[model samples]
Target: MTEIYFNLLGNSRESYRKNLILKFLEEKAGSGTGELSSKYIYYVETTATGKKIYLLRPANLNKGMDFTVHLKDVQFRLIGPFKDRPTHSEIIQDLILKKEENNLEYEKVKPLINKLFLCQAVSDEEYRNLHFSKGIEIEGILKIIKWLFIEQDITYWNFSGRKMLYESLRINNLV
Candidate 1:
């Protein structure tokens, strides 16, 4: 595979945050447990004053859809519906609605992981209900991340290391 270095940082005075993450991932991909996984992390940064949003996306697009594993402050959201349908974009709203109804929080889901075996933060059962598509359960989609934790390779730090991102709330802190 070719080494992909995205124009990534744009023209920020100090792109330390992005560079830190890029370097870290490159290291993992080059010669680490992460090297075994076909998926690599891709990110998008929006530096809008005090609120900077960093979205980590996977380079491999879904067949006719897009999949997203979004982590904001310790909360990880697995999202996808394959493609557009009767109603759309309201997906986030639906998540918000469901979250509100269930009173769910990251803390609640954090304990579900099988620390001794899978790196997965959620069980196949827990992931079942998060689908944006109509009543479909999420399966192989998240299985893609199993190697990262199955061998105890990647850690929470990859998601929110101090330099990897400017202002990040860590899974470590939450747990």
Candidate 2:
């Protein structure tokens, strides 16, 4: 599974947040977790005001789709699937070279993630109805990020010490 999130302090003057995340990911990809880790490293993209958004996926999971990100309060869509497995560098090149349309498989999902995970919005019946697309459940997506960041302790701070996101998931029975 792949996970994406909006950085909480997105437009702050400290532009080095992006560099720090890249450096950490690069080191982990190169030597920290070996070959498999490199295969599934995280990718980040920034908005015009310097807010950083990110994505992560496991090597064996979905190849993921190409979608566009709108940072006017953080929105995304899964336009289509990838032709081949993409590396972190390849993704960076694509992002730098063009307006990269990336993947997720559902158009409305990421904003929902922002709301539930970052904004700490309480989930309700309407949310459950909207959580499925082509047989994929949003629960799996939530689990992926939770495991990687909270359980694995990779950039654990991004998820609010696992408080907001985890409580939202548990309340909604999504994890």
Candidate 3:
């Protein structure tokens, strides 16, 4: 009877360990930071023992195997895997939802926009939208600009939006 009791306990403990490992892998796979460069897509993997491993592969090639790349930490960050890129509005909404204290109102954001315009970080046309534009629309434009800036990609605009975003972030101190 002692052997039977041990068998039952051992099986249950093994099943519990497997379940815990599966949960950890699922969580990491779902929300790990990813990067898309000109040639490769990079990702970080953490082992069960908490060791970080950087991996990379051709950005456009699906059949290529993942190659390990050694790096302390990649400075660039994408929302998640390259499978999906979130929209600017979605990013802003997520931030707002994450913290209710984010001061994203038009009145608060307008000064930042004006400051960017004065500093020439944004063009005149980009700075001033339509005279009849609503407060929400203007706020959204600024938010999008900040998102593009944070992403550090100039594909959207000729000039980098980093300066404008940094200045605005300092002033707003959004959560």
lDDT of 2 by residue, 40-156 (tens): 323343422343334434323432221221122222234434322232233223322221232433344445544434424324342343423322133333323322222222233
* Shift in Å, residue 136, candidate 2: 3.2
Candidate 3, run of 10 with poorest lDDT: 1-10
Question: Per-residue lDDT for 45-113 in model 3, tens only?
Answer: 232223233323322334222222322232213556431333344444434442343344433544654
Error (Å) of candidate 2 at residue 22 is: 30
Model 1 quality (TM-score): 0.23
Off by over 4 Å in 2: 1-105, 116-119, 122-126, 131-135, 146-149, 152-175
The lDDT of model 3 is 0.34
Q: Tell me how far the alpha carbon of residue 36 in candidate 1 is from the true structure, in angstroms, after superposition.
A: 27
lDDT of each: 0.30, 0.34, 0.34
Number of the candidate with higher lDDT, 1 or 2: 2
Residue pairs with colliding backbones in model 1 are none
Model 3, stretches more than 4 Å misplaced? 1-39, 44-83, 101-153, 163-175
